[model samples]
Target: MPWLATAVTTVGLLSTGAAHADTFVPLPGGEISRTLGDGTVVTVRLVGESATISPSMGATPVHRNAWVSGRAEVQVAGGIKKGSIQPGYVVGCQVDIAGGGVDGGASGKTDWEGNASGGLTSGGNLSLGPGEATSFVILDRESANDYGDESHSSANSFKGSEASVTWADSTIGLSGCAGYAQARAFVKVKVQTETIRTVVTLWGQPFSLG
Candidate 1:
């Protein structure tokens, strides 16, 4: 894992004669390798992760906003090479999301759904009170189904041994939370081999939303 110091800069001024600053946080993305029952090794990597925290347009203490970016890569070896990757983020309002009760490694089988303190949403814009959290997928790809009907999916499928997904400037807006807030990124990969199928997840470092 590679770590970089976080950087903050004053981007502009607010309407209330207050100096508004945007915080740029450089995250140390991670990598993890998992071995399947059939001796297949699946590797997941998260790279170039960062977030820009900006003051919300509401300009109130209860409102927060951020722009996140990252890249997720997957490589499968020694088995049938087909997999899917889903990238997402979890936002917490006054709730501990610092990998508590979860494996604190480059990759882990953390139960994201169980750890979430609130209901999940399809989009980034959210509202939560204290001690609540939610997760949302970043990709909403639009495509035609087999019958030529419009469809939307959050995961991207790929064949062969290697595939990657990149996202930039994904918006996260939170309101109704009057306390401190935090967020973390995750990449979930599902791999299928001739003998078995497995899923691996990679979690990024948690960052503040103040």
Candidate 2:
């Protein structure tokens, strides 16, 4: 009887572990690298992420809220294939964060902040309130690339490697809120080249505001 009980417990443990094995676990701070077909390599890394209590933007010191911030670093090599004609790509990296929180104060009870980052252009962006945001310069682009597309411009170009970016969002805070948060870093380019056309995605560890 004792041996049978032990075997049943082992089976239960194994079942629980198998259920979580396929879960997508995010890293708090890590690096991911990808090489494209033509001969381009891009690496995106997050040094760290933090949350703090700061004064409200328009309100007085009487108000407190969560401020989320992170440092994004990138390393790129062999990403250009310039020519007289043919197709070319301007490759670079971008940083983004997706998360939600709840405020304890008179502010909105539910806070959901998504896609807040300067994507491959103007370096990076700090978190704006809910709908409004600003672009923060982390790794500056050497020169704005123009692929002769009207709808697109150089403002969204992170054309070089070895660039650094720092971003902070006042609205996506937890001073008076608590919930979940996620940080993501990815590579972006105007057009896909023979090389440089792969899905480059990396995620940081999730955050909890208590």
Question: Which digits, one per residue and each the tens of the lDDT, describe model 1 over residues 140-191?
Answer: 5567769997755566677677777888778888999999999898888878
Index of the highest-TM-score prediction: 1
- Per-model TM-score, in order, reads 0.81, 0.39
C-alpha RMSD by candidate, in order? 7.6, 19.0
Error of 2 at 30 (Å): 1.7
lDDT of 2 by residue, 103-143 (tens): 11111111111111234333222232323222222222233
Worst 10 residues of 1 by lDDT: 1-10
Off by over 4 Å in 1: 1-18, 100-120
How far off is model 2, as Cα RMSD?
19.0
Worst 10 residues of 2 by lDDT: 1-10
* Candidate 1 overall lDDT versus native: 0.74
